[model samples]
Target: MRANLCSLTFLLALTLQITYTTSKHLAERPSFLNPCDYNGANFDKCFADNFQLLFSHWHDGVPGLKSLGSLDPLSIKRIKIQQDSGATLNIVAELENMLAYNASKAIVKKATLDKSNFEVDATLELPALYAEGNYKVKGTVLGLNINGAGKCNLEAARIRLNFHLATKLRDEGDLTFSDIVSLKAKILEIGDFHIDVQNLFGGQRDLEATANDLFNQNWRELFGILSPTLEQTLELVLKDRFTKIYAYVPATYFISNMPRASEFYG
Candidate 1:
């Protein structure tokens, strides 16, 4: 009788062990048995990958600005970008005193990035010029930002931008010049800016000569002499005061294929 009782006890213990092991295995497995488990880790991974793919294509697929028609000489090119990954970028393209008459070209000279965000440094090259009114360099941003939270699966954040120009003095004379000249006032938003010309020609002969040449329709000659100076000035100003002039402008349009969700899991 005692032997039979011992056999029964062993059977009970084995049954309990099997039950415990099965329960633990189920717990370790993914809790995605139901369709409502869309909020699981698998979903997060899928969403993140899709977002990155979309952004990469947008950045590299868009045609360069050169495809666009002639840009105005008085305007500077500006680019701003934001990402859902908490990254922000800003880029400015300066004409570098390129002549309006020449077939000017702008290129991305250098790019800096912090993990996910990137900023491009650009320079404009123009043929020699003898005349100058106001020259412009065109800049644009071709990127997208996506933010997901709560019930909304995606949101485009804001990006702000502000641009300024400064010219070096060329002659030794007190000449009043305006830096913040408004060209197409309506084209830019409320905060666009221009150079502040206050007695710019007080003590520079070369600058004065170049300015005169620019105004006299000798744009080709002016470009050769002034382009270097303009490039230097732009580098200095951007390094010293870019943060102050920086603005956060929002994305203009959405470029994502992801479906908008009414709610997200944390």
Candidate 2:
């Protein structure tokens, strides 16, 4: 009798263990459908709308900018701009001074959007771009410190970004819904960031003359070397803004409809 009782107790415990494990596993399973499917919501419009709404909030800096972290006073310990063979100049630069770039307005000139691709032609009016830095040059160029500050402007800047829809289940209390898993935005064109820096050599005639020769005579060389840093700075600014937006907005908000899939996928 005791043996039969022990056997029955073991069987009951095993049954409970199996039931608990299965239930937990099922509960953890995601409930949303793949976002890229034909049956899923119209992601093209979703992306377009989000982008438009995003621009509206750009005046104050990307929505939720504070949460992402500071993009201001971007640090550039040192950056080198190289030239191609037979190029007139090569330069190494440093921003000992901090840069303050404030965009007063942002307008999307044009945009192409779909489930798989995205692109935009936009302009950001940076009413203020203060520069405090120095540039040292080598290779067919004047070697000296260029120190100054002035107005910076970026006009008709074009950006091309492509990404696919990703979905994940977000649990809030007793409710759960799909959310954007992750995304990446690539800047095809950093556009033109021109700095009208003064005092190339603190009014030193010889150095200033060489600087003029390098810049005026070999403008392409100067642009080639300087453009990368400008591009990277712009990229960081844009990425931070988008990241903040992504955190507050749900994936479904960008889509026209949500379709349920038997299996969950990105």
Tens digits of per-residue lDDT, candidate 2, 105-160, equal: 33343333332322233333332344445444334443433553222222223323
Candidate 2 lDDT score relative to the true structure:
0.38
The local distance difference test score of each candidate is 0.22, 0.38
Q: What are the runs in model 1 whose C-alpha is more than 4 Å off?
A: 1-71, 75-104, 109-118, 123-130, 133-229, 235-266
Q: Write the per-residue lDDT of candidate 1 for residues 50-115, one digit (tens) a residue.
A: 323222332222222221223222122321111111111111222222222221222222222111
lDDT of 2 at 130: 41
Candidate 2 ranges with C-alpha deviation above 4 Å: 1-46, 62-65, 69-87, 96-104, 110-194, 205-221, 225-229, 259-266
Worst 10 residues of 2 by lDDT: 7-16
After TM-score superposition, the amount by which residue 65's alpha carbon in candidate 1 deviates from its true location, in angstroms, is 18
Report the Cα lDDT for candidate 1.
Answer: 0.22
